[model samples]
Target: MKGNSSSLRVSLRLLSAGLVSEEVIKDDTKLVGGSGLSLCDSNDNSKKSETNKALRNHQVLLAAHLEEAAELAAMIQGLSWALKLVVKSIQFFCDDDSIILDYVTDKVAPPNESIVVAKLLKQLALLQTSLTSCQTLPLQRSDDDINSSSLIKLARDAIASQTTWHTNTEEYETCPDCYAHVSPRHKLEVRSGYFHPICFTCIRD
Candidate 1:
């Protein structure tokens, strides 16, 4: 995720030695978390040319109103996945967000509660202790590096293949048309098919 937005896409890579594993994680306020991993190994010199396909794309959801919060949440989720894969050192590469980057790298205290949840702060603290190295760096958009561009394409492709869920919970519901969270206070309209809820913005449009 990037800029002053509520939701965006994330690209993550797991690099071990010279081998690389990749994933595109999509973020939204209305979704939940799911991820997978793929590992590649060389068994024969002749098979070294073969590549292991990237693993499953991830969908991470958080109850956030700012893109910074969503971005931090994505980092947390990605770190958790890395830990599961027995990775002890991690370096995060994200769009320039100095405040969040400083907090993640321990250059400063926790960020504001509004931009970073208190609960998530605690989670990040714990994750930090679990890893030997957890550092953050600004992503480089350079001619020599095509990783960022490729990851963006991967994210778009993943989104095209998936459909949003239209369901209701006690606190919030998802608008079938826009796929944004519909808070209880927002006026909702019930559509004919499956009785899915639609938000006023979608209704107006």
Candidate 2:
């Protein structure tokens, strides 16, 4: 797929063998997911409806990895969902070289391949159809990077809990630029720790 420098960037980190964390950082603000946190942690019943609405609008699937290659498969699944959420193109970063090669280079799978490989291929196809342009690259191995370390911590939490973390409506925050309270759909974040909500208006601007 073609690469667009203006497209939103999403960082996908494999926390553990079975856990993954996805994050978008914008203007010093961070939006995090796949932490396995509940959405309805609040006691107010009035907000429950709002939370539900958010849940329906922003959905992130959390699944446990059963096979060795499940992490790559899960990443592909995440990309497929992201394509539906954002209008502009998206760039995905992950540390797995094998998975990157599998998707970027159209390699034919041998007969009797593992089920995880098959699933990855299927999700990759879906992602291609949904995105106008996409790019997947390897993540820099850096222990000092705050974003990288934070994602690792989130993944550790998910693995310890042994559960899948889905999108919760309450997780949405107001975009700093648009001043509208919405889910994390189409948000933008920078490597310098800047984060803001991205709406159609902001994207156009």
Candidate 3:
């Protein structure tokens, strides 16, 4: 899905692995990057109605090693945003088979060190019952499809923008992958006295 902030126009095209790709239009414009987002502290009431306000607050950060965890975070982020927009039903297309799907759908336990994964799993559990309808399906990770090709370019542009942002900003605590600023809420503890702030999009890439 693609949304333009200036126009409040949203268009859906295709999806995979918790990310939505929209057909680029003449007026396609980028949404504001890095708004506030919080995951674990949200309540059911907040999920149902306060998503915009909540997202305007903090970004959730994960470890560099936790790709599945990041995908889960992106799934939560997309679902919460859709709910905020009052979307009734949702279809998610994932590019590949992922253990994260099993974790969310089957209640499979993550590794003991996967604290972020565990938290995201719990969040997905709450979300599954909250939505009217939601489906997660797989798509072949190939550029043969037009939608897939657009999605790949979108991903590359995002990565480029992130790299540009990092290059122009002053050095501080940042995500190792994207180099975006890492707030306290954006960090996930990976090991003893170690913290890495990896955003979901970067992790997905």
Candidate 4:
């Protein structure tokens, strides 16, 4: 469930106050210590009682949020099917170069997610070719996976193929025109399909 900004802010504050793991209080039992309601008295035990109950609710909320975060991280790292679903949401990032670099990399990929991972890597490499140098980055976050559906694409893509012995062709692979090495590899993308994949630099040149 999505939380409003105020809910999040309030939750963070309560968590900071060290009350996150407490169970939520049931609304049935409140302090009935005072007889005649009079605002003039400082010992309004009902008010203090109310405050305590509210605090517990906040604690339960914060604990739920933290649990969600841990669950997401675990799911992203553990399951391969979920990781595959993650690829659609993910994007690659390069340095501050004023260009949109996109390319295909069928380049003799493996059987598993490695093929998809290769596509992703090839795309990034294609992008980097446009600039002097750049780094490949994954924008999708593995910070929320309680449902285990959030980062499944990434997990699947991460394990497309098993890691094994490699030649310079596989590890420090790059376009023949430019010897620029790919930083983030093992993850490729095979989306939109391509006839002949070309690195961005090669295309521009």
Candidate 5:
């Protein structure tokens, strides 16, 4: 749900007064056999509300072959989703320079041949319609920052737990992406072999 600009600003001010900081998080995982992706908001401490998904099958194949520009498209998709949850206009931080550059400059669209890129463009267009303001910036990872290390560990743990692909016959698992209980009908199995039980609403959007 996108918040009104005035209300969002006020809320941020209130939160800031209490020393409660919020950051929009975008992180990608390149594993041995597959990739794990997460887009979320980090509240103070290690607590996070995130949407985690894995790439598999055709999506994994497409991601594997994506050039730098195409990869940026994928990251944009994640960032768009994260922006929807924010009440206040905020800066988006990611490790990818190409994405930040394109977002900041409003660069040219990605090539038509990449289906994933097309989807990302569509998502961004929708996000623009709903958002009042947003800024994209780069995030540098450092080993010295305890907070950064903890976030990395938290993302790794989520990926580790949700990486396996499961079928409808399998037990129900809560989707990290939407934070909803997923039943078999809405479960999606990735080609990399991890079972991500996503809700229908998330899969659709």
Candidate 6:
């Protein structure tokens, strides 16, 4: 009877181990069937949404920059190119078709002096442009100056003095690779910290 009792106890222990292993296997299978797939899908959707959001934001930024560039171009044409010919009619140099001819102001001036004044005005108006305020300094010279008394002289002096204001020097903004003066008139104007063109050529290396 004691031997039979020992044999029964060993059989019970073996059955218990088998039962525990079966339970553990069921739990692992349920986790794989239920939670694992859902977790993967959730993570994938999160990444997809994140990528979609980034793309939309990039598009919005690009559109805003394009609009800004268009405005700058229009402003340049409006203020800079508008001054190129004085009026809607005078577009080129040989335009001698009855635009207002300004006369000399100095009393008893020599012919050479008068000619020199005209040449000066042409030089001043070279790079003419007004600020964005849609209001520019009056083209007429101030009454404080002796040369301002004559309207013809003032107009001539204005066409010369008003247009010649240029941007900063070449040393303030030079291309690193080529060491050339980059034209500031293009889009992507980098005005940060004394204005320099951050060209793509500089970034290639």
Clashes of each: 0, 10, 8, 30, 8, 1
Per-residue lDDT over 60-96 for candidate 2, one digit per residue giving the tens place of the 0 to 100 score:
2222223324444445545544444343344445554
Candidate 4 residue 154 Cα shift, in angstroms, is 1.4
lDDT of 5 by residue, 148-191 (tens): 44434433334445433455666455554665655546766432
lDDT of 1 by residue, 1-205 (tens): 1112111111223311111112121234323222222111212111111111222223113334344444455456556656655656655555554466566556677545453345555676788688777665665447214444344334333332232433454355455567566563574665654223467998788
Task: Report how far residue 135 has shifted in candidate 5, in Å.
Answer: 1.2
Model 4: CA > 4 A from native: 1-150, 161-164, 171-205
Predicted candidate 3 versus true structure: per-residue lDDT over 30-74, tens digit per residue: 222221121111112111221211111112333433456545655
User: How much is the lDDT of residue 32 in candidate 1?
Assistant: 25
What residue runs in model 2 are displaced by over 4 Å at the alpha carbon?
Answer: 1-68, 96-100, 107-111, 143-145, 161-205
Give the C-alpha miss distance for residue 38 in model 6, angstroms: 62
Ranking by TM-score: 3, 1, 5, 2, 4, 6
After superposition on all C-alphas, the RMSD of every candidate to the true structure, in Å, is 13.6, 17.3, 14.4, 28.2, 13.0, 39.6
Model 6: how far residue 136 lies from native, Å: 7.7
**Which stretch of 10 consecutive residues in model 4 shows the poorest summed lDDT?**
32-41
lDDT, candidate 1, equals: 0.43
TM-score of candidate 1 to 2 decimals: 0.44
4 against 6, candidate with superior lDDT: 4
TM value for model 2: 0.41
lDDT of 4 by residue, 1-205 (tens): 2323332221010000011121111212121110110000122211111011112122223332333222222222222211222212212221122111121223233335333333333443444354332223322224212212322332222222111224556543332234343322522433232111224555566
- Say which prediction, candidate 2 or candidate 4, comes out ahead on TM-score: 2
- Whole-model lDDT per candidate: 0.43, 0.38, 0.43, 0.24, 0.40, 0.22
Rank ordering of all candidates by lDDT, starting from the highest: 3, 1, 5, 2, 4, 6
Among residues 3 or more apart in sequence or in different chains, the pairs in candidate 1 whose N, CA or C atoms overlap within 3 Å are none
- After the best TM-score superposition of candidate 5, give how far the Cα of residue 69 lies from its true spot, in angstroms: 8.8
